[model samples]
Target chain A: MRKTKNSVSYNKWGYIFLIPFMTAFIIFQFIPLLNTIYNSFFENYLVGLNQVGPTFIGLDNYKSLISNGDLLIYTRNTLILWVMCFVPQIILSLTLAAWFSDASLKLKGTRFFKTVIYLPNLIMASAFSMLFFTLFSERGPINSILIQLGILSKPFVFFSSTIATRTLIAFMNCMMWFGNTTILLMAGMMGIDGSLFEAAQVDGATSTQVFFKVTLPLLRPILLYVMITSLIGGLQLFDVPQILTNGTGDPMRNTMTLIMFLNNHLYSKNYGMAGALSVMLFIITCILSLIIFKASGHDKRK
Target chain B: MENKKTKGMSVHARRTFSYIILVLVTILCLFWFYVLFINATRSNGELQSGFTFIPSTHLLENWKNLRAGTLPILSGLKNSLIISCSCVLFSVYFSTMTAYAIHAYDFKLKKFIYPFILAIMMIPTQVTALGFVKLVDAVSIFRDSPVPLIATTIAAPVTFFYMKQYMESTLPLSLIEAARIDGSNEFRTFNSIVLPLMKPAIAVQAIFTFVNNWNNYFVPALVLKSDDKQTLPILIARLRSADFLKFDMGQVYVMIAFSIFPVVIIYLFLSKYIVSGVALGAVKE
Candidate 1:
């Protein structure tokens, strides 16, 4: 009876404590999610003096999204940039994490190294993007150095070409993220049982063999976590691209990502198209997340 | 003797290699910051001339440009502080309360709510951007009120995840039960007993939320349209995107410095906690 009373009061306190968060969640997150879903099916465009509120036009917006072909270009840009950044980031961070986590490779000043590497991760992406913009500008130091080095007769304008612009963005992203991934990977590695490494060594395993056979398998869950989060963040490629291009996604709109495009759509008051793009983005992310969850999660279950 | 010598040589080679890699990486990571600092003190003429690793004497001049308020740097700082600090407070405090409620109590929806919150983590605010802006604009008061910005923290699912994990590992239920037995009220128990115990988690989440909110440009850009209310990121963007001749790299560097100064200070002081906090959050079972 006493225990029952205690639990009853616990339930009441639980509801009380939950009210603030739930209230905000409903007001902010849940409603917006529902609204996005609702808006996606409408025909809303800024035609004249008045803003056209979303009106029901089932399947029209989504249909236009696929037909417009901008979806393909934007999606391609987002994926290509993400892949360019992520491939190098994952490989370098894995090796570093392995090297750092290895007790056998004990080196001093790691605290300093860790802080330095992670420093870029802490800075605002906009600020970092700004830094890169200055560095790679036509008259900036990078171009000057290249000219002085006799690598080019004239300054290689970074933003003047598509490949150069993409590469710069990718390099900046890789530099910022590898440190974070290293820390996470290192922590994941550290959490692995020491005896597993020892046991592999005892069984005449080379360090390479142990890493491939034991460490990589053990690192899967964390790696997937890092990858998926990176992918999600990578998918919403905005701040850097947005700032770097001054919200123009200029040079013929080459750098414009899905989110940036959606942003533009909203800015132009093409509310229906923006909603449709958002839904598509949401669906893409959900699919990607599910695939990753299955791939890593299946291994764990086995 | 020969085998021992070879083994020792390999170990020594490995350690040296590790140090070289680490040093190289450190230089790579910090090179831009070094550049940012070096250029902050240079004149626009000096900056456009070439890369100079040397610090020029124009920091004070840059400071003058920064405070001239062609862009509202000082007010941006104040607004950012007001926005991010309150954001951190709401994020850490309310997230903790929500986590505590779920962790400590026996409610019907406890099981459901836990995963429900986790599910929301996968939904980035970008997905709801259009509707969020619409809702805010419709409310009129909330349109640029800073309420939506601060209130967004209350539903911080990631912080709740960390705090819940923290509660499980560090905050034993027995202690709460003991407090309850002593006739302390539920809120009192949470306020007096629980919060102090969750200091480390609170500190960790506070730093993350602070940085996230401080650097957040997208939502703030969309919502805070007024020049006076715009944060540093927006201001910095404006500086960058300005007419080419008007782009002052020195002023830009100083503004960048000014924008991140508080964050750097906070991180420097709480870095040890920040590192551990990330580890605690990342490697959780």
Candidate 2:
């Protein structure tokens, strides 16, 4: 009887503690998600409270989105930015983590290096936007230095060119985040048993051989984890482009990311169109994540 | 003797190469700080030069002007602190409670819930942003108010993920079971025994959440309409694009300094936990 009562009370307490999170999730996350899917089929307007209803429009929103030229361009730009940024990001992070882990280097001031590298990640996007703007603007330091070094005859308009703008965004993303990825990878490296390294060393393996044969293989799981998370994050890229490009997606809307396009639809009060885009983005993100999980061998365990 | 000598030479050369790489990385790290710091201090004229490493005396004046801007730098600082602190508090309390429940108890829904959380981790924030905005506007909470809670609360997902991961690994269920056997009720057991063990995890989550919230721009830009409620990031962005290149450059530096100071200070003090906490979260189970 006592055991029964105790278990009953424990269950009640558990439910009570869980109520807040569940409530927030249902109201905020789950319900909104359902509404978004539903709204994607309607023509929505920002009507007053008396007429706060959506007009049914079926698949028109999705059809329009598919045929939109700007949408196609945004999608292409986003992919380019992600690839340019993410490839170098993963490589640099792995390289740095490997270098830092080398026992022979015994590099002094590892903490200082780590802290400084991670500092940019802590700064708000606005400050970073401002800082980058000051650096890359036509009269900004980058152009000035290039011209002064006789590398360029004149100041090049960075934001005015699609390639330059996209490259700059990719560069900023890589610069700010490689530190975080490195830290994550390093942690993964540390978890590898010390015995493995010692055994490789005893077998007359060079450090390079030990890293390739032992470390890289061991770090694969964590590397996959990092890649998936970065992929999700890269898809959500918005702040830099929005702020740096002055929110118009200027220089011919060349840097208009998916999120920015979604934002534009929202601002125009085109709820149906925005919701359709949101669903499309969601489906694409989910499918890509699923593919990555499968490719990374996470699916086999389940 | 010849083989040994050659082996020694190769090792030495490798060591030298590694040292060179380390130096190069260290310089790279310093270069970012130098760029931001130098630009922040330069006059508009000198800023056009791009690579000036010399310090200028305009920092103080820039700071004063920054404070006097339309948004008032201090107000941005205040909003940032309030949002970050409140979000941290909410995340820490609820995350601890949820983690405790998940870890300490075996219940009917446990299996379904655990994997659900992991699956949701893959859903990018962009996919949810539009839906969240509509939901928030639909709710009456921010009906007439300028600030929307949705923008601030979207941070809950990452916080929950970190806390759940930490709790599963660091916490031992036996401890909670022991507390129950001692006649402590569930909340009491959690408040006393479990909460103390969670401090390290809490500290880690707190710093990450704080930094993320403090630097947040995109969500708030969408949700917030009033200038007074605008956080530092929005303020900086607004100031940067303002037609007046005439606005005090000194103030802009001051604003940058203000935006960076709190996180830097916290990071300096708790640097050790930051690395360990993230490592624990990102590495596979």
Candidate 3:
């Protein structure tokens, strides 16, 4: 009788503990996600001053997105940007992590380096974007330095062209976030047994040899995690581009990201198109995430 | 012994090379700050003249100009504090409760719920932006109020994920069982026995949740449209695009610095927690 009573009490307590989170989750995340998917099929109208009502429109929204040439450009740009950002970020983060993990370096101030490097990640995205704006503008610091050093005779408009703008943005993003990847890799490095390094040392391993063979191999899972997540995050890149371009995706809309395009539709009162774009971005992000996950063998590990 | 000496010299050379690389990275890390610092000290015209490494005397003047702006930066700071603190509180409260439930229970639905939270972690907030806005609009929570609970910095996914993961890993069921055997009620057991032991997790989650909320821009931007209700990021954006460039640039930097300052301070204090917190949240079984 007492055991039964205890079990019954346990279930009751479970419900109580779950009530707040479950309520918030349903209200905040789950319902909104479902509504977004549902709204993608409807034509939303602002009938009165503020009332938003949806008229069912089937797959017209998705059809419109496919037809819109700008959408295609946005998708292409997003793809290019992700590649530019993710690839270098992974390589540099791996290199930095491996370097830091070196026993011979006897790296003092690990904590200081970690904190300083992650500093950019902590700064508000808007702030970082603004900082970059000041640093990379036509008359900004970068151009001035290049000009003074005679690398260029005049101030080069960093954001003047499409490719230059995107490349600059990608480079800045890599700089800002490589620290985070480094930290994760560092954590993974810590988990590896030290005796393996000793064995490598005994085997007449050079620094490069130990790094390429031991460190890189051991850190593959962590690298994979960082790469996959960065890919996912990079695909959703909105704030930096949005703020940097002053919300227009300027320079002939060259840097317009997929999320920015979706946002544009939303602000333009085209909820259906926005929804469709969202779903497309979602699928792309998911596919990329899955590819990285599979390639990293995260699935096999589990 | 002679071979050992050569090996020692090679190690020394390697260390010197590594130190050079470290110094290079450290300088690169400080490069952005150096640029910002130089700009902050320069006059507007001087700033446009390209990146001079020299510091100017306009620092105090620019700060004074920033202070005298119409936007209440101090109030935005206060709002950020209130919002971030509340978010931490709510996240901790709910996450601990949910964690306790998942940790202690073996109900028919336990298996379903545990993985559900983990799966949701993979869903980025951008996917749910449109739906979240509509939900907030429907609720009309922020319609009449200056501080909208539904729209203003309240709803977050990563917080829930972090809390749930923390609870599962840290809150052992044995302690709860002991408390229950001693005739402690469920709430009492959680409050006295469980919550105390979960301090480390709480601290970790609190710092992360606070930082995320404090830096959050997109959702708050979509939901809270009122100028007064605007958070720091939105305010910064407004200042960025505002007319009166001469009057606004200094104020913009000040506001930018203002928004970044608190997070920087908090990060300094809680830098250690970030690694563990991220690990717990990101990697899962």
Candidate 4:
């Protein structure tokens, strides 16, 4: 009966509105993606002062990249920094989310605290990195304060040590993101069936028991989603580490992430290797996503 | 009776203790912004040795230094505003229109088209950076232009998803039907009728996109090479890397203070959307 009105002309309007977005998406995203795959196989070498040309070697680019150990170092650094940031971030956010959302605590001024906590994330990472850079610099207030407190005998360089640099990046990342994680986790908690918590409490479960048994289990899907997003974002870490260290990832490149490594290769005019690196990133992302998809309970959306 | 009263008193004490602790933590979280503000007000020499909770009086001097510096802060701010505002405008407007189309009308390739866009979200930005740069060079018409960077805003999957979620609930077919009955064309109905209704969603997304693009150092750092073309974050990063003799910490702090001003002001007015916005993104997932 409804098929008469839902005819071809009626549907023509959708395509007209959709054409602009589709044009942009295809040009910017889809074509480039295909270009990335096509370009990944060719090797470009400089033949003269300025002339360079692509020679298709068919997997030679990926072969050379894989043979090198720099990829491992980059992956290691990315994972380590991400783990350092994410472990603390998720824990603190969960604690904060649980405490604030719990009725018994009756946390005061939730809105104000939430706003303040999220404030750091809004400020540019360039500012945060610069602020921390100065704060930790020798003769800066941090060093002065440390000496005054007798924590150090004299001035010390925080960037000198790899651990220190990595820790600093990790800390800054956590500081900026935990508030967002808290809000997301709180939203997840809000989605939990209220009667389940009530049933647990009615069965003589303590607050801790209820939280551990009831709330956490229900939050698994949200946690998985958050973790996957963080994994992607964190692996591509560039700005803070780049700006804070003059894009050098200084002190022996301890803080250089996968994106930084990729950017460096691109700048040096090694387009083939850069494309290969991007493809490598894509492969790793797909593998990890599959692992997550399997590990996460197969709760297909209703 | 005394035992019961003492238990009640202890519970009251615990609540008070919790409040004090939470408040303290909140202040600790905000301490850096305060420190940044304070340092922005102090001279380079004063910032060297001493830590002061109270602000000193070098803000005007610092501003003067920023203006006098090699890197043009004001121009950077202007370029950033134009780039970000334009990106946000294009991103949200097109995304909403696309989502509206998906919601309102039936087309042959509709199902395949939307999920394909959603699927792109899984691919990291780095995956496309290499090819995207090559494409820009292949098509570049001008040097130090923000056009290439702005062009990428056209394909914003995240904004599309957010707008899709919004249009699902807020928009109804009957409204479109009524508008059609009144002899409104599709584009007219969208521009006149639908856009007004999407103001709240637009405002929330605009804030998110503005902050993201304004603070974005990735693409802008790549494309905007010339001093005048550089955005605030890039300029600040340069100032930050200045040699000791050349480095005036005062200018860095002041420039940072300037960079943060727009976002902080916007955040203050729209803090409410943030919590709900996160929830919106999460629940749909």
Candidate 5:
């Protein structure tokens, strides 16, 4: 009788507590999601003083986005920039994680190193981009230094060159995030059992071989998590490039990303195209997340 | 004897290599910040002329100019603080409460809510941002108000997931049973007992949520249209594109520096918690 009463009271309390979160989730997130998909099917925009149709146009937004080829170009730009950053970021992170987590190394001042490295991650992306903009401008310190060092006869304009601009963006992103990636990877590394490394040593395996054979495979789950989150973040890469290029995505629009493309539509009050692009982004994120999961060979049952 | 000597030398060599790499990477991470601060002190003319590692005397003048400029920077700071703090409070408290509900009670929707949260975590906010803005605009109260920004974060799925993971390991049910036997009501027990017990998790989530909310530029930029309502980031962007001001680079640097100064201070104090908190989040997943 007591147990029955306790269970009943607890269940009542449970629902009462969940009410706030559920209300917000449904009203804010879930409803908005459905609304986005609904909006994608309708044409909505503004022309000077006139408001255009919220007219039902079945699949027309998607059709126009694909046919215009801007969608594909922006997607390519986003992916390329992501790859450029992720490759170096993962490599640097793995190396650092290896060194820091190695119990045998017993390296000193790691706390200091970790603290310093993670500082960039704390700064706002907009502020970081602004700093970069000042530092890399034609008459900025970097160009001035290059001239002084005789690396260039004159100041090299960073923004005008597509390669220089993209590289700077990639470099800035890698710096901001590699610390975070290192910390995550280190957590994965430290979780691995020590006996495996001991056994590898007993078999006369070098550190390199042991890392390849034991650590890499065991670290797969964390790596998969990192890759997917990074991919998602990369897809939403907006503020860095947005501020760096002053919302232009200039020098032949090579630096323009998917989010920037979406922002352009939203800026012009073209809700239909914005909705379509958002849906495309959603679908792309789901598909790519699945692909990375599959490629990582993770078992769901685990 | 020869083999022992060689092995010792190799170990020393490896340590040296590690230090070199770590120091070089550290320099890479912090070099730009050094330049930013250094330039913040120099005049626009001095800045354009050359780079200097040494500090200059123009910080106060730049600050004065920045204050005198059209940007409402002080207001931006206050707005950012209010929005981020409120959002952090709502996000952590409600997320904890929701997680507690799932962990402690044998409710009907127990299984459903957990997976539902995990699924929502996969959906990025940008994907739903258009609809969110439209809905906010449609509702008179929410339109142009920061309520939607602070309130929507109450359904923070990632924080919920983390709290659930924490509760599983740290929060035992026997304690709740004991509280029940003591004739304590549910809300009282949660407020007095569970909250104190969950401090470490709460602290970690609070910092992450605060920083994320503070650094957020997208939704706030889109939602807050008025100059006074805008946050520091939007103001900085305005200051950046303020072409009519003769593009005062010194003032620009000062503004950017000021924008990040509080975050840098917070980071300096809580970096250990922040770094370890990150690792903890990743490992539990």
Candidate 6:
């Protein structure tokens, strides 16, 4: 009874400790989230330095978003960019992880390789975008080098071609992230029991077979985590494309992403539209996350 | 014996192949930063002329030009430092406190709070951005101030989750009970005893939080209106988009290098921890 009372006395400290975080979340994140939903139902925009009505206009903003069809185009673009980057990122990371984690290989300088690759991930994305922008500019070093090497007769306009622009964005994203993915997947690979591989080897299995039959199966959870997080991150792809395309999403807006579209509304102070777009984005993220979870059989495992 | 020798030769060949590929990848990763720094040292006219392997002597000229240019590069640097440092402080300290609360105490809301925070972790910032900006502007005090940016950091779910995970593994309640028995108050014990034990987790999280906040542009672009208040990423973006008449590729490179310089320095010092911290996060999950 005395111990129970003593424990009860300490309970208040938990609530007290939580107050600051809870208060900030409620004010800065939670309430704003609800406000975004609420604002979606009202008409609010700026008209040439004039504040327009936050007047009630139920479903209109969402209606226009649907009717206009840009959402579909942007969503497709976002997904395409994500797939472009994610596929290469996963493959390269997997390959690197395999090489680094292979004990028989006894690869030298694995630590150096890991550190060098992750350096890109440390730099600011916006700054990295600027570096790319300058390097791939019409008369930039990349073009000049290629021309000097007789690969191209003239400087190619990278920002002008849709394929080149999209590829560059995807490539940059892949470059920035493959190292991180490599590290995560490497850690996952390392955690598998050594005996599992030894057992496979003794059973007349090749390395490839052991990887497929034993290694990959045990790596499902980490793979699932990487994919879902990458998917969510893919949905938030903004800084690279934003800075790369100069917020134009040019080359016929092929590089335009979902967050870029939302940013346009936010930029214009079109609260209703921005709010509506944010709601759609929120829903899409939820549905996609759920679909991924379901597809992975995560629930069954749990 | 002959067959085994051939197999050994093949294995050696494959290992050599892997080393070559890794070296190539390492070059691919480091080449851009080299190019960036090399370009930073060239004159604008030299830049327009063509690419070169060797850097030129125009680095000081470019630096002088960047300082003289309309962009508030130094102020932006200062703002970024202040903002990122403040964010690191708030995020690491408060998240540790919240994690400690959840870890140590057996309150009624213990089960609920843990999952609730985990659920909240998935809610991306872009979803809350529109309303955040609106709410900020509506509340006059928060408008055009870093308060919202700094305040919002207190609820960093990722950091909190990691801290809670760390505490669960390393922090023992018996330690806290012993401290209480020694007449140490909860706050005092947390400050002196708990914080010391959490240094590794704290250091790792602090570096990440600092780098993240320093590089953050989206929310800061919306929040800070004044030139002096802008962070480095924002300034770098503006520098890139500046009109052709005033455009200097050399200065642009210099400014970007300036922005990334600090982060690279910090990273060089703490990369081991950062890499391990990332792996730790994944393994814990």
Each candidate's fnat, in order? Answer: 0.67, 0.57, 0.55, 0.74, 0.77, 0.77
Predicted candidate 3, C-alpha RMSD:
3.1
RMSD values for the candidates in order, in angstroms, are 1.6, 3.1, 3.1, 2.5, 1.7, 1.5
Q: Tell me candidate 4's interface RMSD.
A: 1.7
Overall lDDT per candidate, in order of appearance: 0.86, 0.75, 0.74, 0.84, 0.89, 0.90
Question: Which residue segments of model 1 deviate by more than 4 Å?
Answer: A48-53, A297-302
User: Over 4 Å off in model 5, which ranges?
Assistant: A298-302
Residue lDDT tens for model 4, A203-283: 867667887888888898889888988888897788889877887888898888989888887777678888889888999
Candidate 6 off by > 4 Å: A298-302
lDDT of 3 by residue, A175-280 (tens): 7788888877777886789999999999989878888888877777777777777778887888788878877777898899988887777777667777777777
Q: How would the docking of model 3 be graded?
A: medium
Judging by DockQ against the true structure, name the best candidate. 6
Q: How many pairs of residues collide in each model? A: 0, 4, 0, 0, 0, 0
DockQ of each: 0.74, 0.55, 0.56, 0.70, 0.80, 0.82
What's the chain B TM-score of candidate 2? Answer: 0.88
Off-target runs (Cα >4 Å) in candidate 2 are A1-5, A45-53, A199-204, A298-302, B45-51, B144-157, B244-246
TM-score for each candidate, following the candidate numbering: 0.97, 0.92, 0.91, 0.95, 0.97, 0.98
| Between candidates 1 and 5, the TM-score winner | 5
Quote the lDDT for A277 in model 5: 94
Model 2, range A92-202, lDDT digits (tens) per residue?
788778877777656567777777667667767667777677668776677877887999998888888888888889988887788899899998888889899999988
* Tens-digit per-residue lDDT, B52-169, candidate 1: 6789999999989778848988888889889999999998999999999999998888889888898889998999988888888889888777789899889899999999999998
Top model number, lDDT: 6
Of the two candidates 1 and 6, the one with more favorable DockQ, higher being better, is: 6
Worst 10 residues of 2 chain B by lDDT: B143-152
| Per-residue alpha-carbon lDDT of candidate 4 for residues B184-239, written as tens digits (9 for 90 to 100) | 88899999999899998898888888999999987677667788789988887787
